[model samples]
Target: MNYQALFEQIKKKKSFLCVGLDSDMKKIPTHLLSSTDPVFEFNKAIVDATADYTVAYKPNVAFYECRGAVGWRSLEKTVIYIKDNYPDIFLIADAKRGDIGNTSKMYASAFLENMPFDSITVAPYMGEDSVTPFLEYDNKWVILLALTSNKGAFDFQFFEENNKKMFEKVLEKSQEWGTKENMMYVVGATKAEMLSDIRKIAPDHFLLVPGVGAQGGSLKEVAKYGMNQSCGLLVNSSRGIIFADTSDQFAIIAQIKAKELQKEMENLLIEYSIL
Candidate 1:
């Protein structure tokens, strides 16, 4: 999906919530395990329940990859289901992949072509060569890891080189690889204070923020500092929404959680005069 389409969805739904389908097989309702594909079943229910309140769906690849071939198949079915059913919602493959140039191209093709994801999260530690390959695909996005919310982020992302934070340099240098249309950065909501600096470097690009809810990041603070003219933020809530309940009514509970976030986001959009 293009940036305009994304912004329109945000405005239309009064939301910028991206529901993370980080569905774990072990964590899903016990009854779902009886289905032919429990993971896909869980995802389908969550997607159906929360689709109205969210603008995007992100499935963290690790959850599926850990299950091996069956996991991958579940991911494929999940993406296909989303495309066929909810064509307008943006799909992100939360793979966080980055490698040598050739390998990166293959990874890009695998996710953007074969699996048909609208975007994929990418690690930027390897530099431009690792990321440019993903940008080769049209109307697809590369969400580069920037200032993450993890405790270890300070171990390296904040390290200074010539007085500039490492992640700041990553944002500045990555602009050469792709335009705002096809490139976004992952700014963890837990690190909301750093968003001002992030905006200075990436004023027009969307940010896939992942540290809200379960990670205890302030949604209001994220909007105050990170939002742009276009309401450029996709705040994700994984565990808080998807795992809202472990019962058979989990999906319904997930929708309630997502709706709460969407309502808050709508208020933020109105406050910023973006909607």
Candidate 2:
């Protein structure tokens, strides 16, 4: 989807929520094991339940890849199912892929061309060559890892040189290769305080924010600092929404959780004067 199309969805739904489909097989309810493809079945249910409240869905590729070829098939089926049914929903391959130019080109084609993902999370450490390949596809996005939510982020992301942090350099240098339309930065909700600084650098580009809910990232703080004129945020929640329950009513419970976040997002949009 294009930038305006995405903003339209956010306004239409009164939300910018992205549901993370971290569909780990072991975490799914045991009843689904009887199904032919438990992971896909679980994902189908979760997608159907949360579609009304979400503008995007991110499938963490590792969850599927770890299961081998069978897992890969399940991932493909899940992506196809979302696109076929919920065509407007932005689909993200949370693969965090970035390699040498040739390898990155293959990776980009594998996800952006072979599969119908709207975006893919990419590591920026390899610099322009590794990330530029993904930007080759029209209307597809490359979500570069910037200020992450994990504790380990402190090790390198904050390292300074001439008073500029590593992540700051990543954000600055990356802009030369991609624009707000085709590129976004991953800023974890846990680091909400740093958002104002991030906004100064990327005031208009969208931010794919994870680490809400289950990770204890405050929604209020995220909006207070990270929100922009276009509601440039896609706050994601995974375990706290999808895995809220493990029984037959999992989907129903998931819907409730999603709706709760959507309602809060609507209020945020209004408060920020972006609605």
Candidate 3:
């Protein structure tokens, strides 16, 4: 989906919540083990339950990739199910991939073509050539990593280059490769204070914000600094939503968790006058 369509969805639903499907086999409810495609089953239930309140669904690639071909198949089924049923739901493949030009193109095809995903997480350490290959797709997006929430992010993102933080430099430089239309950024919600710094550089770009739930990032702080006139934020919640319970009520509990966030987001959108 293009940025405009996504924004419209946010306005229509009064939500910019991206529900993370980090479904792990071991962590799923035991009842799902009886299903032929347990992983897909789990994701489908979560999607069905939360679709009304969410604008996006992100499947952390590692969960499916680790389970081998069966896991991969499960991932494909989940993607196809969402596309077929929830066609407007933005699907993100949380595969943080980046490499040389040729390799990056291959990775891009694997996610954006072979499998259908609206966007994928990308590491920017390899620079423009590694990142832009993913941007070649018309409506697909490359969510470049920036000011992440992890503690270790300080080790390198803070490095100075021409008196600018490394992530700031990444934000300034990558803007040349793709506009807000086909490119976005990963700014951890835990780093909300620095969002003013982030907005100064790329005020119009959408930010795919992780770390909102289990990672303890504050939604209020994120919207306070990160929101643009367009409500440019996709605040994601994973385990805290999907794994809210491990029983027959899993999907129901997940729905409640997502609704809580969506209600908060609705108020944020109103406060910013973007509703």
Candidate 4:
């Protein structure tokens, strides 16, 4: 989807919430395991329940990849289901992939071309060659890892280089590879304080933020500094929403949690005059 379509969706729904379908077999309701494809079944119910409250759906690739071929099949079915049923909902493959030039090209083609994901998360540690290949696909976004929400992110992302944080440099340098339309950065909500400086470098780019509920990141603080005129933020809540309950009513509980965030996001958009 283009920026206008994304922004319109945010405005129309009064939300910029991206539900993370980080489904794990261990956490889903026991009854689902009896189905033919439990992962896809869980994802389908969650998508159906929360589609209206969320503008985007991100399925972290690791969850599926860990399960091998059957997991991959579930992922394919999940993406195809989203594209066929809700084309307007921005679909993101949270793969966090990056490699050498040739390999990166294949990875890009696999996700952006063959899989029909609107965007894919990519690591930028290998520099332009690793990322530019992903940017070659038109209207497909490359969400570069910058400041992440994990605890270990501080070990490297904040390392000082020439008096500037490493992530700050990543944001500044990666701009040369792609424009805001094709490129975005991952800014963890847990690092909300750094967003003020991040905006100075990437004023127009969108940010895919994780770490809301389960990770204890402040939603209000993220909006205060991360938002732009277009509400440039896709705050994701994975465990808290998808696993709201381990019972048969898991999807219903997930919708309740998602709507809570969406309602707050609507208020923030109104406060910022973006809606």
Candidate 5:
């Protein structure tokens, strides 16, 4: 989906929430295990329940890929199910892939071309060639990892040289390769305070922010600094929403959790005059 289409969904749903499908086989409800594909079934239920309150869904690839061929099948089924049922919802393959140009092309084809994801999270460590391949697709996005929320992020992301932090250089240099239309940055919600500086650099680009609920990132702080004229944020919550309850009522609980965030987002949008 294009940027306008994404904002349209946010407007229609009164949310910029992106439900993360970090479904782990061992973590799903015992009831779902009887199903042929527990992970996909768990995802389908979550999607159906929370689709109304979310604008995007991100399926973290590691959760599926770890299970090998069967896991891959479940991932594919989950993707098809969402596209076939909720075509308007943006889908992201959270693969965090970045490799040589040739390898990146294959990864792009796998997710963006063959699987029909609207975007894929990518690591920018390998530089332009590793990222540009994914940007080749029209209306698709490359969500390059920037200042992540993890404690380890400080190990290198904050590295300074010539008065510029490593992530700052990433924010500036990447703009030369992809426009705001086909590119975004993965700015962790835990780093909300730094958002003001990030916005000064990439004012219009959307940010796929993780670390909100489970990671203790404040939603209000994210909006205060990161929000733009279009409410440029896709704040995600995985365990806090999807795994909130592991009983038969998991989906219902997921819906409730999603709605709580959506309502908060609606208020923020209005406060920021994006509504």
Candidate 6:
């Protein structure tokens, strides 16, 4: 989807929420295990339940890829279901893939061309060649990892080169390769305070923020600094929403959790005059 359509959905839904479908087989309700395509079934239920309160659905690829071939099949089924049923919802493949030139092109093609995701999370450690391949696709987004919420992010993301932090350089230099319309940065919600500085650099690009609920990232702080003119944030909650209740009513509980976030988001959008 293009940037205009994304903002349109956010306005229509009164939400900027992205539900994470990290549906681990071991974590889902046992009853779903009896189904032939347990993962897809679980995802379909979650999507149906929370579609009203969400503008996006992000599927963590590691959860499915870990299960092997069956897992891949389940992932495909889940993707097809979302594309067919909720064509307007922004679909993200949370596959942090980055490699050398040719290989990067293949990964980009696999997700952006074959699978039909609007965006895919990418790692930028290998520099321009590793990431630009993903940017070559029109209307496809490359969400590069920058200032993540994890503890280990401080190890390398802060490294200095020519007196600038590594992530600072990532934000500054990447603009030369892709416009805000096609490139975004993954700034974890836990780093909300730093967003003031980040916005100074990338001003208009959207941010895919994870680590909100289960990881204790504050929504208030994120909105305080991360939001731009179009409410440029897609806050994600994985285990907190999807695994809210591991029972027959799991999807219902997920909806409630999503609604709670949506309510908060609605208020923020209005406060920022984006509504």
Question: How many steric overlaps does candidate 3 have?
Answer: 0
TM-score of each: 0.99, 0.99, 0.98, 0.99, 0.99, 0.98
How far residue 97's Cα lies from its native spot in candidate 4, in Å, is 0.5
* Best of the two (2, 3) by TM-score: 2
Q: What's the lDDT for residue 157 in model 6?
A: 95
> Cα lDDT for residue 90, model 5?
94
Looking at model 5, report the run of 10 residues with the lowest lDDT sum.
182-191
Candidate 3 local distance difference test against the native: 0.94
Model 2 C-alpha lDDT per residue in residues 151-227, reported as the tens digit of each score: 99999999999999999999999999999999999999998999999999999999999999988799999999999
TM-score of 3: 0.98
Model 4 worst lDDT window (10 residues) = 131-140
- Flag the better candidate by lDDT, 2 or 4: 2
What's model 6's TM-score? 0.98
Candidate 1 segments exceeding 4 Å error: none
Clashes of 4: 0
Per-residue CA lDDT of candidate 1, range 1-275, in tens? 99999999999999999999998888999989999999999999999999999999999999999999999999999999999999999999999999999999999999999997999999999998999999998899999999888999989998998889999998999998998999999998987988998999999999999989888899999999999999999999999999999899898899999999999999999999998
lDDT of 5 by residue, 46-160 (tens): 9999999999999999999999999999999999999999999999999999999999999999999999799999998999999999999999999999999999999999999
For model 1 the TM-score comes to: 0.99
Give stretches of model 4 more than 4 Å off: none
Lowest lDDT sum, 10 consecutive residues, model 1, at 188-197
lDDT (tens digit, per residue) of candidate 6 on 45-150: 9999999999999999999999999998988889889999899999999999999989999999999999979999999889899999998888999999888889
Which stretches in model 6 have alpha-carbon errors above 4 Å?
none
lDDT of 4 by residue, 1-275 (tens): 88888989999999999999998988889999999999999999999999999999999999999999999999999999999999999999999999999999999998999998999999989999999999898788999999999999999998997889999989999998888898889999987988899999999999999999888899999999999998999999999999989898988999999999999999999999997
